[model samples]
Target: MDKQIIISIGREYGSGGHEIGRKIAKLLDIPFYDRNLLDEIADAKNVDAKKLEKYDEAPSRMFLSRTVRGFSNSPSVNIAEMQFDLLREKAAAGESFVIVGRCSEDLFKEVKGLFSVFILGDYETKLDRVMERRSLSAKEAALAIERHDRNRKAYHNHFCNGKWGDSRNYDMCINSSRLGVDGTVEYLKDYVDRFIKTL
Candidate 1:
C-alpha cells in the first residue's frame, strides 16, 4: 500500500457491488464512496441532497436527443458533473479510496494505480437478492432489476466513453454469483494487494 490505490467498481443491479466496495475499503483501510458521495456534493455545492438522490446514476431526460446542449443544465447532468469534479479533485490530491458506480472507472482513467472492476451476477441470483433486500415480491423485484439495469446502462453509456459492464473497460470483470459476496470481497482484497505491489 505504498502507493495510492483507487478502486472503481461498476456493477449490475443487486450484484453486491456496493457491499464489496465497502468491504474492500475496510480491508484496505481506505475511504469508500457510494450514496454518501451525494451528501458530500450537496454540502460542498449547496444543493439539495434529496434532489441529487433522485437523479443519482440516472441519465439525463434528453439523453436520447443526442445534443449536449439540450441537457447541459439538466439536474442529472449537473449532478454528474459535480460528482466528477469532486472525484477528480480527490484523485488529484492523491487520495486512495474505493468508489462504487458513478462511472468512476471512466473518471479515473488518467489516474495511476487505478484498479477498475465490474461485477455481475446471474439474473436469478440478482432477482432473489433484490427481493429479499427490498422486501419486494418476485414480480416487483424483477421489474425493479430491469429498470435499474436499464437506467445504469443508459447513464454510463451517456456519460462514459466505454460501454457499461463491458470487460474491456475494466481491469477485471467478476461474476459475483460464482464467489458470493464474502468470497468475492476476499478475492478482490488479494487481487488488490497484488495490484498495489506493481504500482
Candidate 2:
C-alpha cells in the first residue's frame, strides 16, 4: 500500500466489473475511473464532455484510416489519445487508482505496479443481470450485451497490442458469476495485497 499501484480491469457487459472496481478502489482508498474519465478528459482538454461520450468506448467509424495506422485524426482517436495522455500524466505523478476498461492493461504495461484483470460471467448470469439493471426484456438485454461487447472488443483490439478479453493478456481473469460483486471485490483485495507484497 505504500507504493503506487494501479488496477486496470476489462470486463464483459453485465459482469459487475464496474461495481467490483469501485469497491476495490474504496477498499484501497484510491481513485476509481470509469465513465467519469470522459469528464476528466473534457476538463483537461477544455472540450465538451457530451462530445466525448458519443465515442466513449465505441470504435472509430473511419475503419480504413484506423486500420492502416492504429489511429486516425477523427474525434474518437483524438479522445482516446487525450485519455491516454491523462492516464500517463497521473501514473507519472505516482497516483494509485483503479481504472475500468479503456484498454488500460496495454497502456500501463511498462509500469512496475500495474495489475490488470478481466472479468467475465456465464451467459445466463450476465443476461439476467443486464435485464434487471437495464430494465429490459431478456431478448433486449441479450442484444444489448452482444452489441456492447462487440463494440468493446473492437475498441480494445483496435488500440491495444493484444486481443481483447484474452486471458493471456491480463494478470488474472475472474468469473464474476462465481463470486458475485462483493465476493469478487474481497477476493481481488486479497489478491492485490499479495501482489503488492511481491512487488
Candidate 3:
C-alpha cells in the first residue's frame, strides 16, 4: 500500500465503526480522525465546539440557532465545511489517516490512495451494542439508534450525492455484527493489505 493512504469509514449507529477505524489505524501506525476533527475545525473557525457537536452528522435545522449564535453572515462556514477543509488540508499534505463517520467517504471520492468503507450491523446486534456502550435500556438504545441512523442518513444525503449505508457508494461494506469488532478490524487490515498490493 502507499504510505499515505487515507481510510474513510461510514458507519451506522452502534456499528463499532469508530473502534474498528481506531484499531486499523493502530495496526497501520497512522493517525485517526473522529470527533477530534470537530475540535480542530471548531478551533479553526472560531465556532463553539458544543454547537458544532450538536449538529455533527446531523442535517442543518438551525438557521435561527446560527443567527442567534452570531453565525449569520458566514452561514457557509458550517461545521461540515470546516471539517472538509481540515480533511482536504491533511490529504493535500500527504497524510495517512483513518477517519470515521463524517460523510468523508463520499467527500474524498476523487482523492488517490483513499479507500471508503461502510460498516453496518443487524438491528438486534446494533441495539445490544448501543445498550452496552451507553448503559441504556433496550428501548432507549433502540430509540437512540433510530434517531442517530436517521440523522446520519439525512446528513449524508444532504451533503453527498450518495445514500448512506448503501454498498454501491463504498469500496467495501462490512457487517460488523457478523464478524464482531476485533474480527472486523482484522478483516479490514487484511483487505487494505491486499488493496495496497494491487496499487
Candidate 4:
C-alpha cells in the first residue's frame, strides 16, 4: 500500500464535496472520516453520538453564545477533544484518510501531512444537487441549503476563525458541482497523484 496521507475537505453545503472526499479515500485505499470523526469522538467520550452530530460543525451566532456553545460541563467535550486529538495523531502517522467537515484541516493545521481542499458551487447548482441527493422537494432543498450554509459558516467562523469556503484556508479549492461528483473525484485524484510525486 502507498504511504498514508490526510485529505481534509471543507465544503459548502450541497456542493457534492463529501462524496469527493470519500471517493478519493476509496480509490487510495484509506479510511474516510466525516461523521466517523464525531462518532469516534463520541465513542471516546461515551456521549450520545446523535447529539454531537446535531451540533457538529454548527455554532450559535452570538459571539458569547458561541464561546459557551460547545462547552459542556459534562465529560462529553473532553471525550470529543480526546477523539480529535487521536485523529490529529493518525493523520501525521501516515494513514491516508479523507476527512469531511469538523474543521479537520484547522484542527490538524500544524500536522505535517495534509491535502486541504475547499469545495464550492453556485447557489442554484448546490440547491439542485441537494434536492437530488437528499431526495427533498425543491422547497425543502432550498431550506436545507440556506440553513446548512448558514450553520456551517457560523460554525467554521466560530471555531476555526476561517471562512467556510475560503481558498486561503485550503491548499486547493474546486468547484465540484461544475465538474460533477465523479469528475470532481477524478480531478482530485489526478491532482493528488501529481502533487505526491513532486513531494
TM per model?
Answer: 0.94, 0.94, 0.89, 0.84
lDDT of 3 by residue, 1-199 (tens): 2566889999989999999999999999899998888788778778787776775665766454355454443333377767777888998988889999777887788876788999999999999889999999999998999898888887788778888888999999989999899999999999998776765
Per-residue lDDT of candidate 4, residues 3-91 (tens digit): 45678898888888887888898998888887777776667678778877655555653533322565654333344455567777776
- CA deviation > 4 Å runs, candidate 2: 63-71
- Point out the worst 10-residue segment of candidate 4 by lDDT: 59-68
* lDDT, candidate 1, at 124: 94
lDDT of 4: 0.77
Q: Assess each prediction's global lDDT (C-alpha) against the native.
A: 0.91, 0.91, 0.83, 0.77
Off by over 4 Å in 3: 46-48, 62-77
The per-candidate count of clashes, in order, stands at 0, 0, 0, 2
Model 3 clashing residue pairs (backbone): none
Q: Residue 33 of model 1: what lDDT?
A: 92
What is the per-residue lDDT of model 2 for residues 42-70, given as tens digits with 9 covering 90 to 100? Answer: 89779889878988888877644443466
* Residue 115 miss distance in model 2 (angstroms): 0.8
